[model samples]
Target: MSAARRRGSPAAGLCPAAIDRVRIRCPQDVRRAAEALHAIAMDHGMRAAPAHNIADKHTPVDAEGNNLAREVFGWSDRKAWCGNSRIALDSPITAACRFESEPFWVNAQGFRTSLPNHYLAAIDLANFEARAMTRAAIVVPVHLPFGQIGAVSFNPLDPALTELDDLFALQGDAFGVYARTFVASYEHVMGSLQALTAAARLSKREVECLRWAAIGKTDVEIGMILNRSRATVRFHVYNASVKLNAVNRSQTVFKAAQLGYISLAS
Candidate 1:
């Protein structure tokens, strides 16, 4: 295990007092907790976007109905941060977050992750400046249950600063803990509906079928391996797709893997 995981507290670098202040229980607590993290980020010469759902266009709002992005980071331009805009679709920073769970810094040059991810390199950074808006940022990805991906990015106040290597090194882990805690708590308290339908449950046979399908097994091939008829295998797979609300066979397998019904690794 990594040293950070080995530690008792995920918020290793933060004091207990600061960590306590970062917890959110109700919608009212959202702004308070976000401010606490914003203060910590500012101490390190960075501005915080306390909570952001990468897939959503609207930024998360507190009880008082203040937009966290505008209130905390002072970014008035909503489209610049996130929306159905070209920037939202083509941002390298958010793209990197999709591949990387750990904290990573990015600039116009490229992404710097704890582990080398060739996936980040494959992302087109052609209009990085125009898309990403910031010159550079230290991003913490918060991958939540049911495939919801949240993120918090700390950008340097100075527009001229494009490099965040030193700042990220000093504060990446702490930022990660704070970012995850704030976003996760906020989501738990504020999320109106579950990502999956209530009927989204699979049977043993369905799981068995998906496990085989995830590894590229055809229905006939899976039936041969599982000692079932191809028609029976198809029935289980189709039932699994209905439960998962998946449109196609591939989506069925993908959602099954996401919900832990089947292991894609296996």
Candidate 2:
């Protein structure tokens, strides 16, 4: 079933009864909890993936066999019992691991598949070899557009809860809702955190000058356009370079552009 696009609207094809009984925990806390999720693994011997950013994962692996965390989510820090771990950006779990036990995220084109084994680490593994993890795991698939795939995994081996699929099936909607709300809150927190970081914030003039320099403009030319001396223009550019921690003017411009302090286009 397709997730409803309406903000604050819970996805359709969910149990109203389960939702009503379900209480969404602190979303701010939940989003922050993506870090140290290992505690959740330790708490119940079950791992939980709160948000999986697929954008960074849509690439080749690095030396450590992992991509930048931006692939799924960022600003991930452990708030409670969660930690830094994301699901496969393109994996079978996207569909096969839905709350409804149907394809969680699919379209007319095809299924978004990823490293299936990694995504389903906490999922059922009777057939595949089970790695030593917190005894159980619960995975809630959260699908967002713009190639954003979010899933919250929870494995609570609480003896009181058994019949894995049945129990998950029972609480699926609540989990889905929690996943939805948490993603929204997570984005907001990131925006704020980014703003809080201390770094030289460029003035409009400096930003424009830096952007123009990135296109191979000379200081004299840039100064003539801005009605400033080349020396003054160079100073601003140099200050920006320092803030960006670049070794040279070109590297400074590149780093500044990457951080989005200025545009690279001339």
Candidate 3:
């Protein structure tokens, strides 16, 4: 769906005007724009390319991680032009990365807030601490219905490049447009998987349990507070977890918070 153009993006940091002037474009329009981003990055002595992802909170990684149109810039591979990451499926996978334990889910940047903004991942950086990859990385999170959250990854293949979200955010809107069109065209490929969110109607008990979980309450605590048995609380949590397609409590909490089922900070 074409979202109505907004006048501003959240907290436009360094290049507010540039981001505001940015517009959306399809694969055709991107032919020129992608070149411009690459050229601009190179002019600054950097390399960069665009990546697109679909909005399915099911996995944090882009099911189609890389955007080949980006090859025009300088990237070497297109296998990722359409790839997937397990982020949504398991972002801070229990053992893959050493993420500090937080009671609930976090945005891409690892913040416990659901404010309308985007997130970036450091892992996408080319070679941080001896990692063999590109130099710079930019990530943008797009929220869609049914708990679908997709994003774009722009990583300049330069092995010496270094920048933060601010640099790439300059083309925030442009990248946003490019990603939208890419997904729209590729939506057919993504197909209609089952919705991974709350049911058509969440039960009052489910809301109560979710609200309690938002506050970091365990089943025992919630049961005590609601005058029910721990098993009852467990039942509610299990039901909600299944509905969100979450395998564990933390994931359920995170997905629920992501969907506004509960306030992350509250």
Candidate 4:
């Protein structure tokens, strides 16, 4: 079926393919976006399931060691394989990011045998679990600055839907575009929210220091601008980093921007 015709499916309401641009701001929006991507896959005669994002490296595992996929996508009859697997650390989605810094596809066969050569034997047990749970996976890697890395993954559930190879060959670029756009929008909103929440605790002096830093001013230069001693400037910057949970000056500035506390353009 043609992409447009396939998108005519009612499920496409969750992921309207005709829309050229969108701003996804919440989980519901994400689900809609995911659904749309899945529709795109189906348009190419691929048997597909709902699309979902894998948890990033920063996401914490649960007490039972479950990742965000189970929670974010929520549980459904179609999601049994994911919930059964329970862990994300060595799953195919994560491996897609590990094996390459770019978007990639892994089929059932690749799931069974793909691994770093050095740990082939030692990692066999982990690989076995992944192979069993994930029959096929297409991961679109999103790499952002300051060590943020993640992916949007599509898992085909219906046994009848099995054109993954052909889908990748024909529509991979389109899939990557949708995945990248969604990931970027998600990160922007969440990062802003997190920064805003943390920025509330920042002192006035800290904000000043970070603003100057954002504009490329050095500690000594910032001191000159503020008529404070260099040591005092450094102290405020350090304190700001502490308050922002940032590891360094650059991160402090970046966090401040994320929170809308400072503008880099100025």
Candidate 5:
């Protein structure tokens, strides 16, 4: 284990006071929590942005989509691509999402020379975006056991402000801890809030179709199970997808489960 792990999570005690002041029951609460995290990241001389895989799913396609997962909270000055760019497929932020543990940093030049070759291409892609944003970033991946995954990115306004070495030397452990705790709390409370609010947006039939779809039922199969016409089942599923702003069957199932309209569990 790294010293950070041996020493225990530094983020554990960093934000309790600020987090205690916010309620995660509403969108406003989420925003406030984000602000608190940003403030914490700033202590290390970098601005903070939070990105979520709101669907609670992560795949290359998920990052490649028009929306890079979802932008639950972010810095106003952050590059549009940082939150909504399809180019994220090759970005280091997406790469961080795949790490079992440990944080990753990417700068205008590239990822640290120590990163293995398999991780280089993604970091190369991230370097292009980093240059565009005039910043270098480090991401703290947040992987919750219940299928929620996300990250908090800390970026310096100017790539030259400090070397990646200094940033990591000074605040690496704090970044990991804060990102993990914040993302977990956000998902737990937001999951409940979405369950209540999102249900009202989906009709009973829509929910039924989505639940079935989540379990690997094809449209025709779903129709057969529900004794409805295939076209009818497709219609309900399409409507649910549209309501959730989902782009495909996989995303549709993911959104349904995230909002608590369906469960993909055994």
Candidate 6:
């Protein structure tokens, strides 16, 4: 069957031709998958960063200790991009990823997306190139389980090309599909920790309680809002905590936010 006909099948988002190239069943598959993605990106005048956890300071490497950033994209100084420092905290690209799940592009002016996000507009872009270290880029944000956000940036190999509006229009969707597939498969095979418990599913009531709790509603307040007794509200929250393997009410709410059951945004 054609790739489109195989939608929703195993490794659905990946192209049929790339399915075998990018499947990550072992450690070595990570590098193989990354190379497959790199070849596609280079065709569009871009370089790829296969996987990056926005919250992490260390650059992602293959299980064989190959720095994908350095080897794939030729970024020599890993520290300048990411390290035991606050670069992620200070990066506007990282800030944009927190609020956006779709693909977007950035330049010295600011972030550009299909939809207008006030949150992205609010970020400071005074030193855009200095912070992001690229004249411009098309970034795909991959929000994962446990609230982990990964990103793949396609930067123009040409230094003078600071705008990507036309290129984004032409190949953005293709890049989004490929980027998400590579990052998600890489994380599935290479991630060190299990991101969720088997019974982490929350019911509608549990989700409602956590959503209210995330906004700082006390149990009594949430009970009043939901028209349930205070004791009932407490029970649901506690049940959610048990399901999520969280220690306390706060962690329970946080985990729910991570799992996308609750939104932490104001």
Using TM-score as the measure, which candidate wins? 1
Query: Where's the lowest-lDDT run of ten residues in candidate 6?
Result: 1-10
What is each predicted model's overall lDDT from 0 to 1? 0.79, 0.46, 0.46, 0.54, 0.60, 0.78
lDDT of 2 by residue, 1-266 (tens): 22222223344335454333222234334323343333323443444444444333332112233422332233133421123133242233433443233222222222222223334333443321122122334455545432245555554536344224433444444455655554444444431233223645767777888877877889999998889999999999888776666678887777677666767563
RMSD of 3: 10.2
lDDT of 2 at 160: 42
Candidates by TM-score, descending order = 1, 6, 5, 4, 3, 2
For model 1, residues 1-266, the per-residue Cα lDDT tens digits are 01212333454566767877888898889888888988988888888864457877777788988877777657666434743355446688778778889988888888887667778888777877777877889899999987788989898888899977766666787888888888888888987666568766799888988888888999999999999999999999999888887889999988887887877784
Task: Give stretches of model 1 more than 4 Å off.
Answer: 1-13, 195-201, 212-235, 238-251, 263-266
All candidates: TM-score: 0.80, 0.36, 0.46, 0.50, 0.52, 0.77
Candidate 5 whole-model C-alpha lDDT, 0 to 1: 0.60
What are the RMSDs of all candidates, in order? 4.4, 12.1, 10.2, 10.1, 9.0, 6.3
**Model 6 segments more than 4 A misplaced:** 1-15, 78-80, 201-240, 260-266
Q: Model 6 clash pairs?
A: none
**lDDT-best of 2 and 6:** 6
Task: Show pairs that collide, candidate 5.
Answer: none
46 in model 5: Cα distance from truth in Å?
1.3
Comparison by lDDT, 1 against 5, better one: 1
Cα lDDT over the full model 4: 0.54
Q: Model 2, 43: alpha-carbon shift in Å?
A: 16
Of 1 and 2, which scores higher on lDDT? 1
Give me candidate 2's TM-score against the actual structure: 0.36
Candidate 6 lDDT by residue in tens digits, 162-200? 878777766666677777777777777778766466766
TM-score of 5: 0.52
